[model samples]
Target: MEMNELKAITEGLLFASGDEGITVKQLARVLDVQGHTVEHLLEELKYDYDNTGRGMLLMQSHEVFHLTTKPEHSPYLKKLLETPQSTKMSQAALETLAIIAYQQPITRTEIEDIRGVKSDRPVQTLIARSLIEEVGRKEGAGRPILFATTKDFLTYFGLTSLEELPPLPDDINTDDLEEEADLFFDTFSEQIDQSNHR
Candidate 1:
């Protein structure tokens, strides 16, 4: 096929892959072209998108290629994400998120220890909301999955960085996580509002 047709096909494959994206080797196999040719097409496609001022950009992560909106459009995207209809976090979710936000790369066990309750459901909820993710595993037995906040977490909270989060008390009272969650949520919500307006 022609170069333009192959480039179009490559772009379609990336789109169809969604968040999972496509790998150079995988694209080569599917396109019946060599890996180097796939790489060339990707570079050319990236250049075309950049030079043509397309709303989408090519992002490569760990050999995976994704077609995503340009970063310059984040304000519009954030507006959609912050709509009032968005799901509000439950008390349990808020507590769990607060702990994770402060003590990130923490395990579910550690979160449970602080909250003094099972955190499986809350962790799953955060993962589903794209607020937190399994960054990796711990060092010890069973090697439990370690969770950390995602970029979406920062976006949703209207924070530029984790440092922007309200500071935790010098002595966090783990015994009263319910009250702690309430206090944190109140402060956190205020910060979010402030961030959005700035």
Candidate 2:
């Protein structure tokens, strides 16, 4: 395929990969080209994005490439996020989010065990919002899928990292878990509101 065609295909793959991004090796394998060739194409693409006055940028992190909006466009992105339609989160979803945040890499069964109710819908909602994702699978009989918070979650909460999360109270009673979830949601929402105003 032509270089231009390969570049276009690489762009699509990068967009589809989301936060996971794509490695040069992965791109080369998919495009049936040498690794160095893929690296050259990526450099060309990155240069084009930098010079074209495009709203988006091609970013490299940990040798993985992904498409993301330029930092200068953050104010507009914040505006979009502040819209009521986009900010809404149901109570069930909030509860699930709190549970996932506190006990990430947790399985659905574990979440249900804590809540004492079915959590399929809430889990789906979190995934749809891009706040949580399938981080891995548990090592057990069924190898149930494990969920974890995403970078989007940190941004939404105005947290720089997971280490910034408030520590959970020790020696807490099991009955207070639901209330704790509510507290977590309130804290996160407060931070998000503060971030939106800035």
Candidate 3:
């Protein structure tokens, strides 16, 4: 692939990898490039982010690199996290949250299977709002991260515990709960994507 295409794929992979980040070897394997080429592309990307005053930075630790918001932008990011209620959870987000709440420690694939659609945005939205988090990794192929509701979720919903969640209605319709989860990190990711080109 061309250098520009490689760079774009690298950026998208890093974003999709989320908090887990991605190793040079992984990028090389996926991009069909050499380690040095991956390194060079990363360096070039990092330099672009640095010089362009982008909202995100390419950060690496323990040989894994991920995209992260600039530290200087924490106040604004925190403001977004703090006021999640301002952007109400979409039906998709609510449905995803409900799934996670009832089936604590589930993987995104499982959530998606239940929802019959992708759950990335909703999961990201929940994590950004501190409503859900990775409790651990499920032991198996790829070892997907396991998600569970958080204390903040309990507080936000005025629930004493998981048991406090009311039983699902017998007539519940997944179709009715079908809406895009729109809040927090999804917006954050979009803004970062926009700033990178500015």
Candidate 4:
């Protein structure tokens, strides 16, 4: 097929994938082309979109490609994307989400340990919203639920995967023995404040 035709097909596939971009390997398999060819096509497509005056453009973040309308177009887009009918999560839910995001595959007991308070309501709310999920059962007696972020969580946060999470500051040493006590209080204090506000 012509490069132009392949580019068109690739663009459509990327659009259909939404926040998940097709890897060059995946695109090559589908297009019956070399991976390098797909990469070149993607670069060309990105250049075309960038150079054009289109209100929407193709962008790749965390190896995922998507067409995002410019932020300047928010006013026009909001009418269709939002209705005053959306359900906003409570502050408690946001805190719970942050904890789960940083320490996933953790059990409720672990979350409580980190938060120094009960997380039942926030955990339930996150699960109901399809953000966090029971990824597995712990090996211990009674097998407590082990929670983890779901694909919906990644999409909602505009991340391709957990690996795309931003780098943490090197100064914040998570393993420092001296800072352990302070870290616990800091994490739990935020949780308490969120709970009280909710």
**Candidate with maximal TM-score:** 3
- What are the runs in model 1 whose C-alpha is more than 4 Å off? 1-86, 171-186, 189-198
Model 3 misplacement above 4 A: 61-64, 81-85, 168-198
Which residue pairs clash within candidate 1? Answer: none
User: Tens digits of per-residue lDDT for model 3 on 9-81?
Assistant: 9999999987667889999999998999999999999999999978999998657798989999989987886
lDDT for each candidate structure: 0.80, 0.79, 0.77, 0.70
Task: Flag clash pairs in model 3.
Answer: 92-179
Cα lDDT of candidate 4 equals: 0.70
> What's each prediction's clash count?
0, 0, 1, 0
Judge candidate 4 at residue 147 and give its lDDT: 88
| Cα-based TM-score, every candidate | 0.49, 0.53, 0.70, 0.45
What is the per-residue lDDT of model 4 for residues 1-198, given as tens digits with 9 covering 90 to 100? Answer: 999999999988887654334567678889999989999899988888778877768786545566766888778765643454435666566666766777778887777666666677688668766889888777865356688999998877667988886544557765553353245344545544554455
TM-score of 4: 0.45
lDDT of 1 by residue, 136-181 (tens): 8778664566889999999987689998987777786767866665
Q: Supply candidate 2's per-residue lDDT for 79.
A: 82
lDDT of 3: 0.77
